[model samples]
Target: MTVDRGVDVRDDSGFTLMELLVAMMLIGGVLLGLAAVQTSALVTTAQTRQRTLGTAVTNQVMEELRALPWNTLNKGLHASFASAAGGDPNVDGARLRPPVEPMIDEVLVTSTTQATDKAPLSGSGGTNVTATSNPEAPGIVFTSRSYVTRPAAGGESLALTVITTWRANQTADERHVLMRSTAYAPSGGCGDPNNQPYLGACQALFSASAGGTAPQTTITAAFGGETTDPEVDATTPILPGTDITVATMRGGQTGVGVTAQQSTAVESSALHAAGSLTAAGAPSASASTGGEAVENQASNDVGSEGAAPTDPSPVTSNGVAGSLAIDGGDLRMVITPGSGSQAKVSASTVTKCTAALPAGVPCAASDLASAVASTTTLSVGATNLQLVRVASSSITGWGARFAGVAGVAATGCSTVSGPGCVAAGASRSVGAVQLGSASWSGGAASSGLIQVTSYSDSTRVERGLSQRTAAPVTARSGSLRYWNGSAYTTVSITGSTSVTASTGTVTWTGGGYTVRATGQVAVTPVTDLASAPDPAGCTGEGCSISTETGTVSLSVHYRVEGPSGVSAFVTTTTLGAARAAAGFKAAPGA
Candidate 1:
């Protein structure tokens, strides 16, 4: 028995220690493989669930936007719904609520692939932990952000973009899921219920009067009458010089008409009275009562009473004999009597008569001779007739003449610096002259300056004559000529001058005379409408919104758990989606 017992004692009973260890190792490997497979399956299932949840959340947000009114689509997120409600579906009233956060699960269950055993995972995964359950473990998170955009091309429809984003898992390296969707809200229903095939209500256009009353008026179509079909061509012909009449649609519509008229013609003329003549032909009547009787005549007259003398020959009256004749369109009186003891012929002896007495006044021979012999200068302000040495006993009478100072030569000084000449630095007054209505040629008299450039010194007061007997002078182009105490010269302008048909006053400056005239300006009436129709739906006459058309957009992103770590998904809708959601099938390219 001792022979085989030695071998059967160990090898025959069971495996050795090394064999047991090898079997144990094989079993451990199989169990480890099963664990790995189980973990992979769990990851796949979680990721799938996450994707479905993300899609559902995104769609939910888009559906919510589709439910809103087209007008309020751009009201923005977080807008209060309580304020926006109860209004016409076509109108953008305050009754619509803005996009609000939807009630849904924003987080996914924790994934088993998290690095740390802690509930929600720490470090990189900590920030996404939204759930309190198992906060120390890895978990998927979902976040949503929404916004709206208006297209550069404006339209009635709005695009709502909903964006949903989430982490695939609680790991730092996990991918994120993003989802986006859009819907549109558009103006629906007829804007005007009373109008058939309604495009919109007929807007009443009217202009108001000052008294707030509407006047019946005719109005022509600017382009043409309104048309329902856009493809159809419509035109309204407006006849030349014809106005269109507007039919009465409602009460209180009024119109107004205006007219404007302006006239600017200036005419000037002069009247003559007995007076003393200055070197420049300006006359100054004296206050004396002793002088030959003279008759007042109309301006530019060559005879008595502005009529041509019937007798062209000489005629005598009283001791003073004279005759009237025309010379170069001028009237002249001639005395045939010779200068002798009978009468005195001298400028100093000449006297201005206060009254008109066709009969001549008698003068003693001795008195006349004494007046002629003395070389006395005439009074500056005295109104005396210029006496020519035609006869000693009798004298010829000459009428006063008026000449336009504008564009005439000065009589006396040839240059601007001399005695009896206008001073170059002194201001002087010009005699008043009457201007006719035909002087100006434009609207209200334009304020300007009148320049005179000539000078002379002669006492011959001739009617319709501008030149004097003294030296002739002219003013410089830019120099203003004025009369000083003894002479005329250029002076600097110091003040404004006023000119009118009746009177004119001026200040001298630069070698020329400038006269400013003022005329009445015409004013026109303006017509406008008190109120206008609103683009957006109107409660009365005002608009509820500043703009009637706009756009809206929404965005969404989604995240979910995946096999590796985390997975991300994203989607975005186009403008076409907005049109489709708005039920606008007729829109182009929708």
Candidate 2:
């Protein structure tokens, strides 16, 4: 059939023109390597979400400078990153950032600027590097750097550093993002052994010494670390004549040292008088009589003899007469002149009597001679009667008498009581006197009486008296002193006494004395030290930097960038397309 058909060629079915231009250049080179691997996976997912939002904004600014207050941690970097219209340094998007300005670029590193690593983030070198502008991602851009170190001597701890740099679209080939971290400020706390600042914590030093002797005393605590031996809580021991008060440890939470107060002393005894007796003048008597009465001879003149007595007598003769009569049972009588003559006497149981005798010696002849033989003799005519002259008596009978002034011839009698008789005109008896057996011859008398002898005297006395008083004491809490050798002088208590802290003792009883107290410990000084900012390229040539006293070094740096369109590129890269040298060329053409 048409064998000649073999010469008719058939191969025009699609793709020619140089195979469609190499299939549109291999599908536009695999869509430009998938749009450069999706813009390098959106720039590596916006650089891993801006490095996790700049490490969460630098761990929230190192937990807000570790909650500040370790003497304010060098106070720096805040205040909205130091002005650029100040306010809004990422405003609440990354939270935690509020120390408001002290040093957005403070730096004071030492040890040769931390041995350099291009060290000028701000450690006294230069170049602060602030650049902030995020306000929660509006075009992103941030840079902050801080460094501080120079404390570590007695080592309380210090060393902080932070550096952050970021860039997202302000493209000058934009591609910077760095964030280094180091944090520590007021870490763990507690220090200030008097380095002159940072006041708080570390106290325990009390002291006392009143131990010269009485009640014994000595207290000491002193705390530097280890020496334990202090505990005298509700105390006691200052009694003998006491007044005690002790208090120092104040409130709670431990750490109490230096606070003191003390007191004690008082004493008394003396008063007495008693003994007595007194007496003077003892013993008494009284008696009286006169004369006349001699007419008793009427019994017929008792056997005769009447008118022969006219010389000075009314004797009418018959027997004993006139005188000697002690009645009331001291019986002693002898009065006879006839008609009723009497006789009854006795008073001499003689016990060695003597009050003077010998003048005619016959007042009963020596101790009343048995009271004249117990009298009773009467021989009238022969005059043999008895009882002869006796006187000196505190009255027993016939104590006072007088008569015989007619013919005047009786005299005598006077040894004690007298105002009358003793001769002179005669016949008189003053007080006690007795004479018996008639014998006054020309005076006609037989006895008289006058006597008084009594006496007594006594005395004794003793005395002593006193008055003046005050003694009262009490002590609580405590603070009373009188040591006065070098110090301590204040003691005044009486009656209501008071002191409060709990613990008491105070006794008084006149005055016996005792007191000495010394318990001292109270110290608190460090005046707080949070003011150290103003130094970061100061300008007047004084960026302040001279610190060393232990613990306080902080450095912080943070950076973030990722807002320029929230970034979106996954991946991309490609190259390779030149060849032509292996084939010949074509030029001429006529």
Candidate 3:
């Protein structure tokens, strides 16, 4: 062997077929294993990133809620959460990019002041642990506490729980997450009558008549006494009274009564027998006797024996006519016939009307004064009276509804049949009218507080906004709908959109469009990593790729508060996985 058999150097250059096969198989197996491992790692990493995002979103919502005012938090006007990443938007169901817009996955919100019976706990914090023994969950949750008391006091506990879920890779073994929020307030938050905070009087009155009618009334009669009808004749210079009756009565004072005097006859025959008698059988009456004669004669007979008269009795008259004759006060009368009798009488009905004029030239006290004091030159026009600078206060109690011309003034008199200072050819409506004046010649109609005037008039100047009718976009209800310049126009979805109306208010919906998720982040993965061989192979450490991803599902629940505002809540989590080492041990003998 010492024979220079130089290191038996055979062709160590190439591998044998069997060896090659073995190598290929081993490498293939290794590659397959690495791929599997890398795929899992990447998936896990993605899950974790998603979970973190979900958690951040949830926390953001909670923080927002926390910063709200106590009342607002308790009320929780608009608080919600949503996933930032959206699902595939391609209608064909193709895998798209990380969704540019977040797919509304889940949503949580608090719109009503009070929560439903199934609401979660009442607090700013929430638990995620599902195990009963866990004390609280680690997932998003909300809690609330409140106190309630009857007239006699008491209280109870309240909590809320909301959960969301979504499909990951379209697997049946779906993932799901939960979140909850709570609020605490007085138990009787609902203003139901039974649960009302306090009770009100709610009283009613009752009487023998009308069966408890709303309004009540009473009737009274007045008696005419001796004050107006006295014994004095038309020419008799008489004293005020005989001091026979008392005008008024005090608590203990007695009322007065009248007594008639007994008549004494001075017979002419007696006078003749006495020696002082005229030939015509007249009695020689002394001054005192003359006065006595007047007293003996009946001046007025209030009550006497005679045939029944056809005149109506005042007592029956008042009773049957439904009239209450009052004395020493202003009396209110209705022109209509009273309850029983058919009698015609012009009567005044008393009503507590407001100071404003109810109708016509019969001006209210305030308007009357305005008409008199207004700076208008009184000029009787040919046909119509023109009121110039006079202001109209007939509508609002605050002040005048219109301003008169500057140079000219109100020139109407009380003789005008219409309003004391009204314009001619003006249309009238409830609470207001349409008129034309030298100042308001713009074909304007006045409202309670607003004035609709034309912009055509160049000569007549006025200090008011001008209005005119415009054509309608479409017509309905027989009449051609018109826009009063300030009304209806074309509306655009995302453009200069506006709603106008001549008579009604304008409303818009879905003003601010946004998408949110309603499901919970059941599982979340934070990180994942994988390694592969590189060139210069002596089984060296390989290059590695790290990634993060997560999945979350949402419940189908959402709400819109107003045209431009909406809210939602979504569940989220974090997940991660990474290889600590990756390599290939050298084959025993290369």
Which is the leading candidate under TM-score? 1
Q: Tens digit of lDDT per residue, candidate 2, span 229-326?
A: 22222222111111121101100000000111110000000000000111111112111121112221111112344421111211121111232222
* TM-score of candidate 2 versus the correct structure, residues matched by position: 0.18
Report the C-alpha lDDT of model 3 over 457-525, residue by residue, as the tens digit.
000001111100111011001011222324322211111112222322111122232221121112222
What does the lDDT come to for candidate 2?
A: 0.23
Tell me how many clashing residue pairs each candidate has: 101, 69, 85
lDDT of 2 at 9: 78
Local distance difference test values of all predictions, in order? 0.22, 0.23, 0.20
- Candidate that beats the other on TM-score, 1 or 3, i.e. the better one: 1
Cα misplacement distance, residue 9 of candidate 2 (Å): 7.0
Instruction: Report the number of backbone clashes for model 2.
Output: 69
Where in model 1 is the C-alpha error above 4 Å? Answer: 1-13, 76-141, 150-156, 168-182, 185-590
lDDT of 3 at 323: 15
TM per candidate: 0.21, 0.18, 0.18
